[model samples]
Target: MNRNRRRGKKLSRALVTAAMLGDAGTARRLLRRGASPELPDAHGTTPLYAASVQGAADVVALLLAAGARPDTESGHGDEGTPLCAAACWGHAGTVRLLLAHGADPVLREDHGTGRAPLDWAERGPHPETALLLAAAVSSRPAAAP
Candidate 1:
C-alpha cells in the first residue's frame, strides 16, 4: 500500500479494534487522528459495523455521532448493513441508535438476499429487537416507503 493508504489502514484497524473492545476513548482518539470511521479492515468491517456486531452500544453511538454512516454495509457474506448486523445480533440499543441517526433499516441487501433490518430482526435471538426495529420502521412516514 502507498504511504497514505497504509497509514489510513492502521487508523482504520485501530478504530475497529477499539470499537469492538468498547474503548470509546481510544476510538475518539483514533477518529481525531483522522481515522475514517467508514474505512473497513481486510475483513471488510468498519468501526461502526464492528461496534454494532459486538453490541457495543456506546461505541456505536460514538461512531454514529461522529458522522459515521449508520448504514455502512459489511463486505462479507450476505453482507447486509450495520443495522442488519445489529439486529441479527440482538443489539436493540444499537439498532435504535442507528435508526435515530437516520439509518434505513430497509437498506438494500447484498447478494440479492433482499433482506432488511426487519428481516434480520425477525430471526434475531431477542424478540425485543424485532419489536424495536418494527416500531422504528413503522415510525418512518409512509411516504418514505
Candidate 2:
C-alpha cells in the first residue's frame, strides 16, 4: 500500500483505540488531524461503533458531528450496527444519541442472523432502553401494504 493510505489506516486504528477508551479529547485531536470517522478498523469496527459499545456518549456525539454514519455496522459476526452495539450493552444514552442521528432502529446484524436494536435491548434486560427503542420503532411509519 502507498504511504498515505498506510498512514490513514494507522490514524483510523488510533481513533478506534481512543474511542474504545472513551477518550473524547484524543478522538477529537485525531479527527482534527484528518482521521476518517467513517473508517473501519481491521475488525470492521468504526470509531463511532467503538464509542457506542463503550457508551461514550461524548465521543459518540463528536463522531456523529464529525460525519460518522450512525448505522455503520461493526465486526464480522457478533457485532452488528452501532445501534445494535449500544443497545446490546444497555447504553441507553448512546442508543438515544444514535437514534437522534438517524440510526435505523430495526436494522439487523451478523448477516441478518443478529437481532435488531430493540431485540438486543430487551435481551440485555434493560427495560428502560428497551422501552426507548420500542417507542422509536413504533413511531416510524409502517411499510405500505
Q: Largest lDDT belongs to which candidate? A: 2
TM-score of each: 0.88, 0.96
Which segments of candidate 2 are over 4 A away from where they belong?
Answer: none
Candidate 1, which ten residues in sequence have the lowest lDDT sum? 105-114
Clash count in backbone of candidate 1: 0
Going through the candidates in order, what is the number of backbone clashes in each? 0, 0
Model 1 global lDDT (CA atoms, 0 to 1): 0.84
State the local distance difference test value for candidate 2: 0.92
Give the alpha-carbon lDDT of every model: 0.84, 0.92
lDDT string for model 1 (1-145, tens) is 5999999999999998998898989998998899998888888878988898888988988888788888778768745678888888888888888888998867756844668888887876679988988788787778743
Runs off by more than 4 Å, candidate 1: 143-145
